[model samples]
Target: MALTLYIDTARWRAHQQSVVQQFPGIVPVCKGNGYGFGHERLADEAARFGSDILAVGTTYEAARIKDFFSGDLLVLTPFRLGEEPVPLPDRAIRSVSSVEGVRGLVGARVVIEVMSTMKRHGISEEDLPKLHAAIEDVRLEGFAIHLPLDRTDGSDAVQEVAGWMDRLNAARLPLHTMFVSHLKADELARLRQQYPQTRFRARIGTRLWLGDHDATQYRGAVLDVTRVTKGDRFGYRQQKAPGDGHLVVVAGGTSHGVGLEAPKTMNGMMPRAKGAARAGLATMNRNLSPFVWAGKQRWFAEPPHMQVSILFVPGDAPAPQVGDELVAHLRHTTTQFDRMLDH
Candidate 1:
């Protein structure tokens, strides 16, 4: 069985070089299954990028990456006070989002996160003073802010960040570095020029790894293939064939995040209408599957299983044979690839 992420190493490294050139001192965020490349591998890749610090989503994620990466590990999400505390490595930098977090982590090196417009994590601007008070004995490493993706490109976000800076200054807290996400290159440059004393560490994940679509590919092995005719039953659910075609089973499914999807960013009314139309078609058993063969996307005979997906090929269209490979266009962040191709 094979569920792989094929790499164009030359092109991938080229893109990484371009990113480092564009955003100096960029912290490559190797979290969330390492954008489908796995965190351990991404940590190794980040080390090759010459980064001193790597950020993971949680402490458990840090253990594996830390073993491979001998750099400072920053866990973005702080361990709450009530939960069972996972002892962090000495090099681990925690994000103290609230006064509770700061109080809980006394003497621990931490970055105080002021809540951004994103509102996913972090404390509010008013709570900064409370956080400042709680971290009296804490080694405050820096500050962190997470900006919403939609507002990442504009000048307003810069002004918003400036407001946070003003609040931090007013609180009389001394900070050196700042961890920021979803800021444009130009915006970061502008901020750097404005605040020369503070080192801005751009926490980048998607734009760092999957930024160049042409540099990477996802593939799965063709485990088996069966010729099916109209009314012939197949698959675990014993789904009957709608027409004469082939039932192709590939080595990727729900376990590997094959049938899973992230929320789509809907822009306008037209896009919403298109999505609705697609949803209607999917209700009729014509759901579009990502597995591609002979330049055409096949349909799933039923819902994806734990470790494999069954695709239906049309009678007129060409089908993949057993032991063949097929490319899958999927969401990397949610996917878990069982294999990765070498250069």
Candidate 2:
């Protein structure tokens, strides 16, 4: 028993098929732990979905994905100067987001990413002419834009995407196709009709693989269990429990993305209150764990180790016996599963 991802293959495949049918031209984004489903598995799934182009994060991933997926591979990150991308078939498309990128990846097939609200990468609208001028010996496949995931204001997405398109067209560059991410269905439909001359390829990741949460489950197998009283000292910190409880050592820790908290995105007052509560707990070095045993989420007995974590389960809660597995709610992109069970 270990950190296992139990997947319902039937429902998973059905969801993938259903999602693909909704979008005419979708470039599946399979990168960064392949959203916890493994890159190779997702590459095969993308190919099985009859996709023609697939987007990966880096050249390191393109090499591996190419082995299993017989489709055009699009590398999302811009290549550095004098950096040699891994040699592969001619189906690879490099993303050139700046003047340097245009100059760096000369004589390569590339997609120019326009800067959206994300602003992490891509060339600015004002610099489109500079990028256009720098495009020599490189084949401009199309334009690319990574939208911010937080843009949930009604039809703002459609307007935002149009703004980029307007800028690109104003530059008088011969761009017709665009690769985009994080747009709603209605926004996409409106954009299609608004710009019939332009082709939009949705670079979908989360909605494609993890849209149906019921199809996937993360479970951590109990490795060790020890009963303790309120006054007993244990763990590396030698801290005593606040009350009588059982120390549940389970598989999956920091190495598997357990107990690692990313900055929370506070939307409104309720979420802010919850964040404040968690912050108060963090100050005491007491954190919560994602594992659920006895029908309740457990707290961390101590900081998570590399491959496993220690969970503190209150005595009043249902205690998990040794070898029992607990369901762990995890961020798929950050987690590394030890086993992938399919049925």
Candidate 3:
């Protein structure tokens, strides 16, 4: 099999429970490589969460789990006016996020995203009136708003949301539901209290799935292990490991999100680099490989390839032989796996 994602089933179940407790009537979102567990698998899990509805990133994503999920499926992406929209399966709900897409979804069950954080779809504030007029017949599941977490207080959030609600209510449009993202609990509570007439739906992904680190881990089987001299030539580029050590080849690489992006910084610091430097100094000035051996980190021989990662497991560490297993932490959305074993 390819790279494997191991989910602590107990922890995942508990996390789901926590999410439901916080936001009752949870609409579990399952989209984009199923966040490394595959779309269909997530759909099945969401079904158990008693969530009869789910949000998907695209039509292709929706197609992946239509059979698995008997509930209403909402496609977040807007289809083009002239382009033939894929026929959503029975009971599927589509989100029309554009002005032009309104008429095309005349008889379809759909939601309309007002303003989205992703910046891809959704009707502009100026043109929303025209779009609302067009969508008079289609059953609007709700008005979707993908909010970004800001440092604002609860009062500020309530005021902003109240203003938005005023505009929606002023349009003389029938509004019932509201789907939001990235909002804090306090803010959501404030909004709920302020607008008791509207049904609130939180479209959470990251904080729901990967929120608990102890619940998730990735693993691959080591295919080979060999001792190498300082100058021993190995790997695709004939790059040397630079030190006497054992070269361990594990089944994971860029194809599984390993060494895929250059680097990403959060808030003003290069988080990856900072973490790396800290670990290097505190540990052994060591670089991390795509694969970890014997509970300790190793160094990659070179940049990762499609499906395999070469690591220089130090000569001193207990080396893993062929068919041995290796483990690593993975960025969910970026990684794809052949199997997701829930323990």
lDDT of 1: 0.85
Best model number under lDDT:
2
* Cα-based lDDT at residue 69, candidate 3: 87
lDDT value for model 2 = 0.87
Better of 1 and 2 by TM-score: 1
- Candidate 2 lands at a TM-score of 0.93
Instruction: Encode model 1's per-residue lDDT on 1-343: one tens digit a residue.
Output: 7989899999998998899888888988988778888877888888897999998988888876778889999898876888766766899988878888888887898888888877877878768667657878788888889888785355487787878887888888775788888888998998888889888889998998899998888888999988999999887778789999988999999998998877788988999999999899888877878899989888888888899999998789877888888999988888888888877
Give the clash total for candidate 2: 0
Q: Local error of candidate 2 at 267, Å? A: 2.8
Candidate 2 per-residue lDDT over residues 1-343, each given as its tens digit:
6999999999999999888988889889999999999998998888887889899999989998898888899998787777764887789999877788788776889898888888888888778778656876688899888888875564477788899888888888866898889987777889999999999999999999999999999999999999999989998889898789899999998889997667867888999998899889989977889998877788899999999999888888877887999999998988998999998
Worst 10 residues of 1 by lDDT: 151-160
Q: Considering only N, C-alpha and C atoms within 3 Å, which residue pairs clash in candidate 3?
A: none
Query: What are the RMSDs of all candidates, in order?
Result: 1.9, 2.0, 3.6
Per-candidate local distance difference test: 0.85, 0.87, 0.76
lDDT of 3 by residue, 49-111 (tens): 788788888887777678788888887776667765666686777777677777887777878
- Which is the better candidate, 2 or 3, if ranked by lDDT? 2
